[model samples]
Target chain A: MFESADLTILAGLLSRYLVVLQAQQALLNSCTHFYQLEPRLARWLLMTADRAYSADLYLPLILSVQQRTYNTADLYILRSLQVAGCSVHWQAANDKRKFF
Target chain B: MIKENFFEQNHLLREFPQDVQQRLFPLLELISLPLGKVLYESGDPSNFVYFPTDAIVSLLYVMESGASAQISMVGNDGVVGVSLFMGGESTTSRAVVQCAGSAYRLNGQRLKDEFNRHGMLLFLMLRYTQSLITQMAQTAVCNRHHSIDQQLCRWLLLSNDRMPGNDLHITQELIANMLGVRREGVTDAAGRLQRDGVIEYSRGKISILNRPQLEVLCCECYAVVRTETERLLPWVFQKGCTVKTTEASMSAAKAD
Candidate 1:
């Protein structure tokens, strides 16, 4: 096995392999799980989040979600953030609509 | 068959008690929304609440570099220009017509007047606003994690839901602009979808050939948006309407 390289080289190679494998596995898992659900609904969730203003910025929680492939738990947390954010919007809508 | 029709289509407004509907309905005026129209540019003072009847509007935020990505889409199912009524008096986002149709426009003063009344209408709009924010937040997540193809599928579905036609009249360039990606990415995604028989594109139009397959290829972001939108604003299903049957029907169709 190529595992017998100098210690530093071996560590670098292993880390690289791990990253590649992680990426591949993430894609495969997302594909499999999403394939199980209705396409429009699944697709909607992805695009919906992309449309957020802070989408370009990283949120600590969202970062944790991104560390893994798309998962139900990640989606749940995303929904919670959406709810909280929306509550703010809800307040604003009510506030703005209050003008006489 | 006037702007009131547009107001009635807004789930939040429709769910309001009759008294609330009466007060708000009188303030709404029918407005023609043409394709490519900008309701207001980013940072402009907000002045109206628009409820689209058939139109699809996109909320886009631009950077100093002039790059922009859509923050959300509003259709008959929702309202636009919440910032006007939300007390912000202005928004950093731009509202543009994603699909050409019509909308019911409520004057800002009148809308605020109604909001001040503080009843079901206020509660409904606020809840709906929460749903919108949820959409914005989730869009950020999806863009970071999902592929362009999955994002395209979700975009198409949302547009299709709002549009009266099956074919979407939009260019890849516009899509790239909305996704904040290069045009080449959209081209590649479109090519893949065409090859997969999931959609057909000619020039600026894209027609769905297999919605079910497209859904399978999409990520979980679509579901999150729908679920959040549903939970934050339960009225999306319509009064007395059951979503379970719709869900079953869709599943059965997909199975077939």
Candidate 2:
């Protein structure tokens, strides 16, 4: 439990974090329009890893891939990322996790 | 020179305080904007600010590869070339006429002078700019999260809100460019809407048949922009409603 003054300071820090996150998102959104898909995907993955504080990402790809058949393009992009030194491990049916 | 009453058609000009109207009106030039006309390219100096009476202007951010995506749109309810008073002489985005119609344009210097007056116009312009920023931010969010189908619904509703009628004279190719998606994606999404009887598309025209249904189909981004716009510029929407009521009564009187 935080004291009243401490809580106010924490709230202020959280709001500042939100503002920075929103600004970064807006910048990324515009930059994605200009940049190539490979670099953009790498940047996104790096950011995701940084935010999560973990190098490994467990993505449920099969379910989403089946729903959107067009994700073949996404798969190809991911493959390129793997070739670019980002290790990708695809798990089996029972354990639906794609580690990147 | 346009008639004095014509200014009222532009929500921004219509709601201007009486003194500001007097000072600003004479400087305005009524110009016809043709479809696909580029108002300004990226990094080009803004010479004039446009107050669209019936036209819609799309602010597009273009890439080095020539691909472009619309960041936001401006219609009668707001002004274009906001960078003039925002203290930026040039903008990175290009402004293009999305719909061909007439608009009143004021020289950028005159606008700056009025803004420097530190009066109602300053507050109004700041509020309008805030709403425009909200729209741009929401567009970024929508592009990342929403499906093409939901985006089309939001786009149609937003465009329809700006115009006086249901018809939108734009092609799927143009919309595809604006949304930064493939033409086939827009075609597929539009086909679904047409089959649902929410809209009718033929040639380059799309007529919205059910607005409520369109709203239902749209994502939350549309509502977010709308609420922000209404909150920032209450007089614009409120005065528009009152004007519509007055026009209805006038028509009824003529019939009687």
Candidate 3:
């Protein structure tokens, strides 16, 4: 288990791709309400990312799982990176960890 | 055709043939996206492709009782509605705005029309689709494993990247909903962070106090995700964006 501070910087670096660009207009314009849920999403992704070992291979595995489950490509690649990390640990370990 | 703006945001854009860029660019539109908005719902048909210029959107899976958890988030570095290019018209997840910003929204048909032209867009979207799937699978794994503190640390890190600061304006209750856990769980996690001097939370606001310490408490998931993102999406991170592994914490974790 790592300290929270180190994890924050690491997670932030991983998620830099999630920052929005300026000047682009939203078709639905629903960020404010969605923003309300960011903390939860962020925390979930963060927790998952912290558990996984490698992002490169892990990301591909995540994509594979979603491809099997969702059958659509409308997913967040960056966020999935975090999820892959978590899944690796969760599946690899038999113990039930109290996360997410 | 992928435009300069699109190319600038995505490194993969440069790998495309000029003709492909030209083919895809005309279809791209400059649009604005607001915060906390719903772009698509579970089972709703997708109608457009979104390339965020300055916004972040969350892909959420809402439970039957209205409880929801965010599966992922998209921003400038990516495009929304990859299913159009990936051969799907809809998905089970809902897209909502995680941050209040802007993005270019392209009509789903226009995007597909251009994609049918098929060259760079086809390949790029496919790779992107692969990346997105990775996140969803990882999410399921993380939710099932890891400690709450570790999870909180990972969450903070992801959010920190989307903004310019350590402070985030979000409520614990809202976070609980997103995590698909009870509000008390978030409160407890926040409380622990506060006690440890890792964060300062007041009302709905959270200020990261010690990033290194927070990372120390988290599992390897955060680093794995970040490293993968950097690898798959080159040009997104600057040179030598190393994952800092402090000596003190390594010893501490081992000792514990």
* Fnat of each prediction, in sequence: 0.00, 0.10, 0.00
- Choose the strongest candidate by lDDT: 2
TM-score for candidate 3, residues paired by index: 0.59
What TM-score goes with each of the models?
0.65, 0.73, 0.59
TM-score of chain A of each: 0.30, 0.53, 0.24
Q: Candidate 3, residues B125-190: lDDT per residue as tens digits?
A: 655655555555455555546666676777777666544446666777767755566788888998
Q: Which DockQ value does candidate 2 get?
A: 0.09
Residue B34 miss distance in model 1 (angstroms)? 1.5
lDDT of 1 by residue, A1-100 (tens): 4433464354444434533332233233233323323342344345545666643323343345334223332544444444344434545668442101
C-alpha RMSD by candidate, in order: 20.4, 10.0, 18.2
- Model 3 chain B scores worst on lDDT over the 10 consecutive residues at B239-248
- Model 1: runs farther than 4 Å from truth? A1-100, B1-7, B238-256
Q: Taking the tens digit of each residue's C-alpha lDDT, what string does model 2 give over B1-256?
A: 4456677777888878899888888888777788899999888888999988777898888877788888888887888887766556777788998877767889988987777666788778877877877888888778767899998888888887675567888889989988889999999999999999999999899999988999999999999989988898886666652232133433443343
Candidate 3 residue-wise lDDT, A1-100, digit = tens: 8676675455344323222111011201122123433343444345446668743224344445654222212233234444445545565776344232
Candidate 2, superposed: residue stretches over 4 Å from native: A1-28, A33-100, B241-256
Instruction: Tell me which of candidates 1 and 3 scores higher on lDDT.
Output: 1
